[model samples]
Target chain A: MTGTITEAAGAADASAPRVREMSMQQAVNAALRTVLREDPRTLVFGEDVGALGGVFRVTDGLQEEFGAERVFDTPLAESAIIGMAVGLAMNGWRPIPELQFDGFAYPAVDQIVNQLARMNYRSRGAVPMPVTLRLPSFGGIQAPEHHGESLEALFAHVPGLKVCAPCDPQDAYRLLLQSVRCDDPVVYMEPKARYWDRRPVELAHDPGDMPVGRSRVLRRGRHATLVAWGAMVHRCLQAAEYAAEDGVELEVVDLRWLKPIDAEGLAASAARTRRAVVVHEAPLTAGLGAEVSALVTERAFGALAAPVERVAGFDVPYPAGPLEPQYLPTIDRILSAVQRTLEYKRP
Target chain B: MTDTTERTFALPDLGEGLVEATVLEWLAAPGDRIGRNAPLVELETTKSAVEIPSPYAGTVVRLHAEEGEVVQVGSALVTFAVEGPAGEADDGAAGQAGIVGRVPQDGEAPRRRVRLRPPEE
Candidate 1:
């Protein structure tokens, strides 16, 4: 009779989840709200985060509800913002600090890359650096100089920092909540371009359900696989939509966590289709695309019908104003790369 | 003889890249006269609940959406029977992008929004 017991836990966990239509900005706001309500030791602070509700309004209404003590604003100093987080995290507090923009994070690189990234290792696992650094990253908002930049390659290169970028509203909420709850230092990159994009988000998924360092194949295809994250993930999905009209079904993979890159999942997707194209907004030379390309080539070399293609930004600095469109890879560019992979010859 | 004009005041962008909101409640009904800066409708955006204001002193000729109805930005909220010509109501003044950087546009948005970090099964 004891052996007759079946594992119905998976079915119970799959009970109807709450699916609400929300944008990435709203999802982030919800995540912060949930954290502040659940954890008394968690604190949110940054420039214009309290009263102004962040420039993107991602932290909107947290101050009004949580009070200034828990959700407060800091001075317009990036280093101080991150330094404060390091101090608070050491003192039994979980601090979520904001750098305003991707370009602004440079001022805090010393604190982030040197101190924060090394604290846990320096302490030999004694100090758990529970700090979540929120950064509005990547281009496409036509931001002026020092507003839009892609720093994933820099952060992902860091040894101890956990890097992740959500591609949709649901992941935005779940991943942020998970990152805040993590014991290590997490770099939470909020895509500035997809903040307003709306989609039906399954809201009932708890933290750790989709843990960090995992990739999801959004669309399954046998012809070729498209790998991307952040804003480029949506662009790749759009390219797949257009390719479907031409009887070409492209598999799209969303690598949510950049740092512990999901090599197994990336390789599986590449091995299945025998053709893989990695797309990103970062520059091509030494960009994250190169790392992804190398991972794909290393893990799935024998299964490949062609070499992995990377459609990425140019090596020059991220252009400003009207020149961004030319610098960032377009849907046409991704499709062209896919076409090349499909038409590959032994020559 | 009273000569009047009508202007359709659509929902303006609520800032922070929000494209639509659900009508929580409507303060003024049709045929009601209201002044500028008057509280018009309470909307529940994804962020928080906000009350919109009437543009100018005008007679409300029509209510475009009922309570609990989701209204898209740039869609008509209320048509006003006012005492001025078209383009004078100044309803679009609130649609300016509040944050730094380029604003988000609908369908094929060149200056679209982006997110980072990081999920799903």
Candidate 2:
């Protein structure tokens, strides 16, 4: 089924290719439009998604172009919305159910963990749950309670769900397209803070299919490997620049696929640098950073010059508007962690 | 004086201070006999799509708004003719009165009041 869609996409790309500067949110909308046009089985629905065009407007104008049946709104019941997606995927429809916000996803976790993630395994590959649960995550937008959270670790821990958090517009567009085509259930986490960050992206030519579970080395360095994903990738890059002043080089690796986690690429980078720092917005305890640190220890243990350091949010619940900046991983914090890793010596 | 034989069911404020909603589809049309608490129309608000039930049990005489039309809260949605005596019309109105003009207090859960059920025999 995906093969035919890919062919159709390839044929569509033949006419003319063009590049456009768009925000991450716009890129997401464009990717959704492209997928909907190429695939008939795909349908998008969530709270206020139709006329309201989604709270962040990431789904703006989709309902108009696709019509109500294709891109419509659902009742404000998160559990029912996701449960329906599970059933829809089981019955041959590719369902993209948006959770609207990160904290609001907790109600749907039961369906996500028990039904969507385990469907293929339970059915022994007889039923393919091509369901993409899109969630706008992370803080910094002064949103009300239950609106700001970075719970990627929660979904990443689940065995069967493929978690992808794209940092920039280009990856946002490409990753979302790939997620829709994947046969397994995917959790597409969009960093709410980076939604409106505009960047020049080539939209004319299809970048072709990006293989899942691959990491992109944004910057190459020798002193230490700095690993980050989603919004924190940009922060890591900034920290790398600051570290360069002190003659400490840091290679920034963007773990695009949070679950499969580009382990080989990470290991290779860690092996070269022999030092590592993992960064994320989630709380320090049980965050995705710990998993990355563990992977480095397991795969590149012999090459390590220092214990893997993690710069992440505190264990406290995401604080109110004023405290968000202090709560998230800042460039200073990341640089300090990198310095700590570089200065460490075995006794 | 208000008419005792008929009642107008206006679009309710579905909480969150929402003023208007696009009428997605009308489940019951004019001349259709709908029972109390039966779904009359599906409305698309800024939060979610919900079915607005008929507050009064009677024949739907007029559907004021077409599908896809945005109707403001407190505006008439559907008119219904009373099945019983004129004096009982107020009772039907009273029973359905809570549907409109009620605002949720702070921290209150949004209104999800449309509970569709088969007409009582």
- Model 1's CAPRI class is incorrect
> Which window of 10 residues has the lowest lDDT sum in candidate 1 chain B?
B112-121
Q: How big a share of the true inter-chain contacts is recovered in candidate 1?
A: 0.17
Show where candidate 2 strays beyond 4 Å. A1-17, A204-209, B1-121
Give the Å error, residue A344, model 2. 0.8
Q: lDDT, candidate 1, residue A297?
A: 96
DockQ of each: 0.12, 0.02
The positional error of residue B47 in candidate 2, measured at the CA in angstroms, is 8.2
Summarize candidate 1's per-residue lDDT along B1-121 as a digit string, tens digits. 5556787777776644556779999999999998877888898876578888887678999999999999987888888787755555455533332222444553772332221110010
Candidate 2: tens digits of C-alpha lDDT, residues A1-347: 43433322223566634567888888888888878888889999999888888876788899988899999889989999999999999899999999988999999999999999999999999999999899988775655567668988999889899999999998998888889988999999998767767887665335455588988999998888999988788777877766666666789999999978888899999999998899998899989988999999999999998899999999999886557778888777776676677667789
Q: Find the 10 residues in a row with the least total lDDT in model 2 chain B.
A: B112-121
Shift of residue A180 alpha carbon in model 2, Å: 0.4
TM-score of chain A of each: 0.94, 0.95
TM-scores, one per candidate: 0.76, 0.72
